[model samples]
Target: MRTLHIITGLGIGGAEQQLRLMLRHLPTSSSVVTLTNPGPVARGIEADGVPVIHLGMAGNRDLGALPRLTRLVRQGRYDLVHTHLYRACLYGRIAARLAGVRPVIATEHSLGDAQIEGRPLTSGARALYLAGERLGTSTVAVSPSVARRLEEWGVRRSRIHVVPNGIEVARFAFDPAARRAAREQLGLAPDAFVVGGVGRLAVGKRFDRLVRAVAALPDARLLLVGEGDQREELLRTAGECGAADRVLLSGRCEDPPPAGAAPDTLTLPSLLAAMDVFVSTSPDEAFGLAVVEALAAGLPVLYVACPAVDDLPPGSAPGARRIGPSVPELTAALREVRRAGGARLPQPAAVRRYDIAAGARQLMSLYENAVHGTPLPHEVSCS
Candidate 1:
């Protein structure tokens, strides 16, 4: 079957990553369209031989894009139209309906309230989202918590389907030799403690709080990955905390380095494997993709206790250490995790629920059901 996947921008966010992974694995003939200029993810998709379309959307409400998108969808005769992020879901779904595409679907990647822009749910934005949901044949939620938020926001439960985000298990599989090589390549002291945090350097990511916590542990070094507008602000915060030297701000390394190399020099998996501990500071993460990646690399994780992370299996290896909202509590937990020594990391089996291939199969089924007017299979618990 042919499907069209639309998103706002193909940046390196969780939603963007999920979309790329799904596109890579989905069986249908799929094409991705970005409402705005194509970013890094667009390039990645194009490399995989998938066509990437840019609609030249400038702002939130681009009325001009609707007609263009509608014409494109109609011309392509897409059987299913899947949208991700806020703007794409709103405009793309509507455009799909206008184009007479059957089975318009939108995946709610994050909770309604946790949208990047502080637009209130009671505002016009929410109204547009609700309109799209009503027009959509189905809605996909990356996590149960995300689905619950959609329900709370008044979307009918019958239209919502929970599909937890998936990862490429083999891509993130642990490599014992690579781990040691990464440490050696980085010239890290044999006993040195490293805590790695991966995410955009934005306010919501709470990187500042992580810096503060890291400052408290003079012996522990911190690795801040990813790039964003707040990089300068975070660097200043690190300087202010007098931990500038201890903090290694390894800005955005999208591609994992070669095997048996350091992250700054090697791939993401190697970088992750070299870490003694992985920490996610975001308080409102919808699904902890980076934390799971760290776990897959066999590093213990310490994340702020949020509904998204608490959903992981209880007895999973490299068992997660959940802390309160305060920076002090996080600092204490970091110290505790470091002192406790190495623990078994989460195995691929524990995280199979988020497998990209499995997630794509489920999404393909949803698209089929949406087109055939048949009810989707009973919602399976990823837990």
Candidate 2:
């Protein structure tokens, strides 16, 4: 059956990463449709030789764009439609239904509680999503917390499926030689303890909190990766915390760290390897992809105990330490992780729960159920 996967943008983010993994493992005939203009991820999909159609929808609620999207899905004769993120989920699912696809599936990637800066669609949007979800065949939640929120917002518990985000364990496998090479390439001293955090520079992510924590610790360097609307604000905050020099703001690195003592772009795997400890200070993360990436690299993770981190398997990695939701607690945890020698890097086997291949298999099954009208045997009861 031909499947059409839809997302808002091709920007490098968690939802985008998950969609890429799903497309990679799915059958060759599957196609990708982007509601907004494609970005970096579009190139990756194109490289895989998958057909991508861009609808060129400018604003979030572009009513006029819906008919064209619906027509494309209809003409393509897609059997299934899978959507990610807010705008794509709403418009894509509705268009899929109009196009008469057998199963319309959506993956909930955000907490649904936090509000976007310029886009303000709260109760009305929630109601719209609820109605669309009821009409669609199935819904996938990236974490249990997101599933709970959907239920609280009035989506039927029976229709929702909890499939946690996954990563390629082998891709993130620990590499000692790569770590050394990355340190040298980045000009990091051999004796310096490096703490790395990856994500958009947003207020909700609380990267400023990390800067504060890093500033309190002596002789520790921080690596802040990724780009966003909040970059300048975060930079100013880092300067205020007196960590401007010690913190390396490597913006938008597509490649992993170099192997064998070369300073190359920090790939997700290499960045995890080059770090003595990985820290996530985000106040609300639907699922911590960067945290799981660190775990897959056998690096210890210091995450704030939010609903997102609760899904992390208990005792799976020695470095998975939870800190209270305070700057002081986070600061202490970073110091302790450094002092404790970063808890002997974890084995890739420990992170099998988040493995992308496994996640792909589970998602495929969900799609099958959506198409065949059969209930998933191990379905998670949302209520």
Candidate 3:
């Protein structure tokens, strides 16, 4: 079936990369519309042979964008309209209804208890979200925890469907040669204990806590992937802790280049291979895609909150350990990990449970059911 996907921006964030990865596996025809910045992930999507259209939305209150989007939706003759991110969901849902599209789906990618897309939620924001939510056929939550959060926010549980975020497990398979090359490339000594964290450097992510924790360990080197508003702040924190030389803020890591393309820089998987351990200090996360990816890479992980692992049965992810959010707690945990030494663990069963191919299949079923006016399932099993 023909589908039209709408999103706020196409940057190198988890949700943006997840969209590109999902399109790669789904068998149906699809196109993308980004409301603003058509950044690197957009380029990757286009390279993957999907048509991407950039909607020049000036800002949140741009009324002109409404008619423009409605017209585009009508002209595309799309069988289904799916949206990602908050702004896109708010606008795309209204536009789809205006265009007479009965089947509209929106994936709530980053919904926390008090924040949506890293912005604090106000009453107006909640009202707007609920108004738009009513126009869609179903709202897909990236995790069961997010679904529960939606229910607590007054959304009908019947309209919330759990479809956890997924990953390409094989792409993250640990490689010894890649590990050696990536270490040399990053100027890391072969025997250095590398501690890695991947996510936007935002306040809510609590990367400052990670910086402090790693700084306390003299022998540990911190490798932080992804950029955000907190770059300068994190560097300053590292400097204050006397670990300025130990922290490496590698800017955004792009997806793997298309097949046969000459590799220009280190891919995410290559960077993962260079790491000895992966740590996520974020106390709040919707699905914790980064933690799952670390598991796929066979890196021992320490996270504060990860619904992807927490919702599953015990032992699903043997390498992952939950810790408190305090700096001292993180410091103590790192000490224990260091005492045990660095050894790559086996890829756990949890990694396979969130396979991208499986999620795509489950999503395809939801699309068919929505278009045919069938009752949506409460949860689409990714495992």
Candidate 4:
């Protein structure tokens, strides 16, 4: 199937990375449209040879780009138009409808009861989202909790499909040499215990708690990867916790190296390699992609709230431990996991369930099912 993917921007975030990973496994013809900020991840998509159409959306209220996007959708003759994130879902759904696209699907990547696109939930936002969501044939949620959240917000249950996020599992497999090199590159002591977190440094993520937690651990250093407006606040928080010297922020790292390209030092996988224990302080995560990535990296994970693992059965991810959202709790969890010498990654069988290729194939099946106006038997979907 020829698919057109639309997203708000190509920044180095979970949804953007997930899109890049899925495209690598998608067998059919595909192209991308970024509404604005065609940043680092855009280069990675281009490196992989996918055509990226940048609709220079000047601001949130730029309605002129709608016609341009609709024109591209019609010209491309794509079989499907899949949207990701909030703005893209709003505009892409409208554009796809204008282009007479039959099956428009959107993956609700970052929404929960608490926050929408890193902002506090509001009735106006809900109304706007529900309005745009009606234009799509299907809405894919990254976890069961998110699927339920969609239904609570007025999306029909049948239209909301639970499709878990996936990653290239083996790409994050444990690598002792890579770990050593990564720590050295970050100017960290070889044996300094590390508690790592990966995500946009936003207020909603509860990174303020993570700073205090890491500070409480006398030997632990906090390595955060990603950039956001919360940097100044987090820096001040670290100082307040007396952990300013122990906190390390790598900013936005390079995208996963493209084929035939040398491995980039500051990439996500490298950050995972350098970490001994991965901590998730997000109090309201719809799905924790980074925690699963930590499992893939063979690091014991301590989470405040992760729908990805919490919504699953016990032992879904071998080393994952859910903890309360507080500094003492996170500090104790980190200490306990570190004492356990870290944990091995989940078995290959477990990893395969969330493989990006599997998710992409499921999406293709959903697209076909939607376009043909009939449900296909045995179609893959996460429970």
> What's each prediction's TM-score?
0.92, 0.91, 0.97, 0.94
Clashing pairs in 4: none
Query: How far off is model 1, as Cα RMSD?
Result: 2.9
- Minimum summed lDDT over a 10-residue window in model 1 is located at 255-264
Clashing residue pairs in candidate 1 (N, C-alpha, C atoms within 3 angstroms) = 166-354, 256-267, 256-268, 257-266, 257-267, 318-344
**lDDT per model, in order?**
0.77, 0.76, 0.91, 0.85
- Worst 10-residue stretch by lDDT in candidate 4? 374-383
lDDT of 4 at 371: 74
Q: Indicate the worst ten consecutive residues by lDDT in candidate 3.
A: 374-383
Ranking by lDDT: 3, 4, 1, 2
Lowest summed lDDT across 10 adjacent residues in model 2 is found at 254-263
Candidate 1 has a TM-score of: 0.92
lDDT of 2 by residue, 267-331 (tens): 77776677888888876667777887887788878887444457546655555777776879878
After superposing candidate 1, which stretches have Cα over 4 Å from the reference? 112-122, 184-187, 255-265, 305-308, 316-318, 343-349, 380-383
Q: Per TM-score, what order, best first?
A: 3, 4, 1, 2
Using TM-score as the yardstick, the better of models 2 and 4 is 4
